[model samples]
Target: MSVSSVDDRQRAARLLLRHPLIRSTDEERYRLVRRYSSDLEEWFEINTGWAMHADSEVVRLEREPATVADPTHPFATRRGGAVLSRRRYVLLMLGLSVLERSDSQVALGRLAEQVIAAGTAPEFAAAGFSFDLSTREERSDLVAAVQLLLEWGVLVRVAGDEQDFVHKTGDALYDVSRRVLSQLLVTRRGPSTISAQTLDDRMVAMRDRGAAPTTELRNLRLRHTLTRRLIDDPVLYFADLDDEESAYLRSQRAALCRRITEFTGLVAEIRREGIAMVDLDDDLSDVRMPEKGTEGHVTLLVAEFLARSGVAEHFVASLVAHVRSIAPDFAKYWRASALEADAAADLVATSLGRLSALRLITRTGDIVRVLPALARFALAEPTILGGRKP
Candidate 1:
């Protein structure tokens, strides 16, 4: 397709939502983006309230409160995942700090040396953090951090193995992707000047550094926040929008919906109550209904039951009972969570959580107020009509 084609815009929009679309990994996308980089940047910023970081080898969109965690995926496995513990997070940041001062092509030995040197400094002593390369476990943790960097496109392996470094057999060399490294610092200002004693305080100080947002800034924030919710979230209800947001949505819903559909190929199914962008692709979202396994069966069954029952609200106890009652039917194939002591409760929670995530049900405490979107999922059992015999 040509650079300025509708197809290009659609692909770009998908990539923007699914970033860090690295040039190293996806050179075709990278080059296409680079060709029409200016337009894509403007479109993303104007429509979604996200900043696009484009350069020679990468096009990354910075989404704040940078949520990268996937409950379904393990911590170490997520290429763009968030660090689990404060200790590991500190190491990640420290490693990044160490990489900042190094050459374009940095050696593993040099990087670790810098990290260890920085850790033992009098300043970072509060964390009581130290990395001893002599210890295998510590070395492995460091390697984990480096591996994460590789996934991030911040570092590309030149000619060495992290396992070698972990085993103390040999050092490794990595060609730092400078474009990726440049966008790594999330904040405009470093935390050196912040007079905050604790991490929370430091974060707050950093957040509050800029001038109070003007009306334009406030509007941008609102648009971006709401757009993110609509895209990432399963539902957007009119009742959920604030006074100002409600007003904005009312005025700009058409324009907003049109742009979203045009760019992302999602059809906006609007109603008096709320709006949802129906993904025809069906593969963009992590959670899927009519899925397999114990969780999937329970979700579909409970959803069907809830839709058929037409209850405005339900207790967890009721769902639990339903799950226990039906366990025997599916228990033969799905043995994992079928017969556990807390099977009923766990199944109920999982099913309800999935339903809630999909915007089919709203859970207030133990009560779930089934929403209108659920009417779509009401399935009719097959009827045995003997037409040929007749």
Candidate 2:
């Protein structure tokens, strides 16, 4: 292939890995995805076991995780950026189901009623879900779920504002995109076919469809799992893998990392503890570090402290106190609200959330263990030999 073709293919692959969905509304990206659809499909299928579908209207990449155990990355509402709680997730699913049977154009109030009906069904009630939208908080949760769908392009706002509906002043209208809606579920098998009694079992069954007994199949599974984790996760820790997976990774690390790097333009940072596919442009990740904002500043400071402390673990409450003690130094740079005594908890939580998401730390209950990756953030002590501080 020519140099330009190689660059274009890498760009297209990176776009799909980052966004995963490009609608016709995103004309340029959708066209790029369509142009390289065949190459992208073969590459992803063979390397990551991910399936990509590109059509005139939309391009969707169906991604299945190697494991469903991680909870660091949660679906957050765009409004306040709060992670979706269990209740909100349930509401989101209910709303999606309602939209599946909805007309092309759906009114906010009509959809709300349908979601409420489905949410409050005897089956759902048995699971302790109750929704009448009688309270403002409940209405806000519904709006958050709808807003998530709107962000995903599954619903297009037609005329009204969702906040007006939240306040009970007016309702909104939306044009549903069934094509995009159908692409929401990415499991290998339909969930209804699982017949598993527990959620964990069902999840396993859904992802583990077409399992066969063979050494080759086992090796293929191991390769796909390792590749998927390395590409999708911020860091792939050796400790997180089983013996077989760890062994396979040890034997094929160079080849696997090279293929991923060539395709996505990511540089692999391999350490003894784990490996991280470092994105040079920093555009591939949803969670960014050292960002510009109060939360970002606090997270950076907290990371520096943890990195320098050299302690393997610390209680979260102790970190809250540490933040409180250092709040005065950052009061001028940080938001006024973050300086309050009560704000230390939130600051600490946000900082730890970012650090944890980056795989620099792992939290077990109240204790946070600093990972080896966090050591890079440590700073050297100032030397008096320097004439003056810059």
Candidate 3:
């Protein structure tokens, strides 16, 4: 490829990585994606097993997580960025099911009624799920789901506002984009074909059943799985890989990392313990460290403390105390509540949450273990002129 071609391809891949679904409404990005559709499609498929589809209207990358059990990244509201709760997730799925059977346009009240019916089904009730939409809270949950759909281009407001419906003062209407709805699921097998009784079994069955029973196929699956983690995750730790995966990655690490760097423009930060596809632009990740604001300040401070303290593990209470001890110096720049002794726990929890999500640390109950990646945040001692220590 020409240098310009390489740059364009990298830009297109970064765009898709940041926003998996791009409609023509995003004019420039959509056009760029379409320009290199064939190359990008082949790259994603070969590297990550992710399917890419594009038409005149939209470009969609069907992505599946390397690890389904990861709970660090949740779907948050586009408006306030509140993480979707279990109730909201259930309502979201229920609303989508209703929309799947509805007309191109749907009304807020009608959607809520259908969702209520779906929630009250015997199977749902047996599963301990219930939502009648009789209360404003329930209605708000439905609105949250609708807002997410709207954000995703699955729904476009045509007539009314969602807040009015939440207040019971009026209703809203939306134009459902069936194309976007159909593109949302990224499973390897048709969900209907998976007859596994439990959700976990069903998930495993859906992913594994379609694979071929051959050595080449197995190796290909391993390569795709590892590449997906390298691209999507903050860090791909060697400790997390199985015996086969570890052996394969050990032999193929350089070629695998080179392919990723060439395609995505990410520099591979190779450590003794793992590999991190570091985005120089720092925009590819959903979570960021050394960020701004009071929360960010506390997180950076806690990270430095963890890295410099030389202790691998610390109790949650100890971290809370550390936060409280430092609050006096930073109190003026932080929120009023950040200085409260009791608020230290919340601060500690928030800081640890960000760190853990970034793979810098791990928390098990009250214990937090600082991982190897966090050492990057450690500060070296400053020296004065003529080699004099500060």
* Candidate 3 structure quality by residue, lDDT tens digits, 1-390: 899999999999999988899988889999999999999999989888889999877899988888777867777775655789999999999988898999999899899888888778898989888888689998888888888998889999999899999999999999999888888888878788988899888888777737468988888888999999999889999999999999999999999999999999999999899999999998898788878878899999999999999999989898888889999998789999888768888888889989988999999999999899999888988766687566
When summed lDDT is taken over every stretch of 10 residues in candidate 1, the lowest stretch is 65-74
Q: Estimate TM-scores for all models.
A: 0.75, 0.93, 0.95
lDDT of each: 0.75, 0.88, 0.89
Q: Where is model 2 more than 4 Å wrong at Cα?
A: 78-80, 383-390
Instruction: Write model 1 residue lDDT over 98-197, tens digit each, in one string.
Output: 8888888999988988888878887668557666688897888888888878878888888889999988889899998767888766553567877778
Model 3 residue 184 CA deviation in Å? 0.7
Better of 2 and 3 by TM-score: 3
Let me know the TM-score candidate 3 reaches against the reference structure: 0.95
**10 residues in a row with least lDDT, candidate 3:** 72-81
> Against the true structure, candidate 3 has what lDDT?
0.89
State, as a TM-score between 0 and 1, how close model 2 is to the true structure.
0.93
Global local distance difference test of model 1 = 0.75
lDDT of 2 by residue, 135-250 (tens): 99999988988988898899999999999999999999999999999988999788878788888998888887576589988888788889998888889989988899999999
Error of 3 at 209 (Å): 4.3
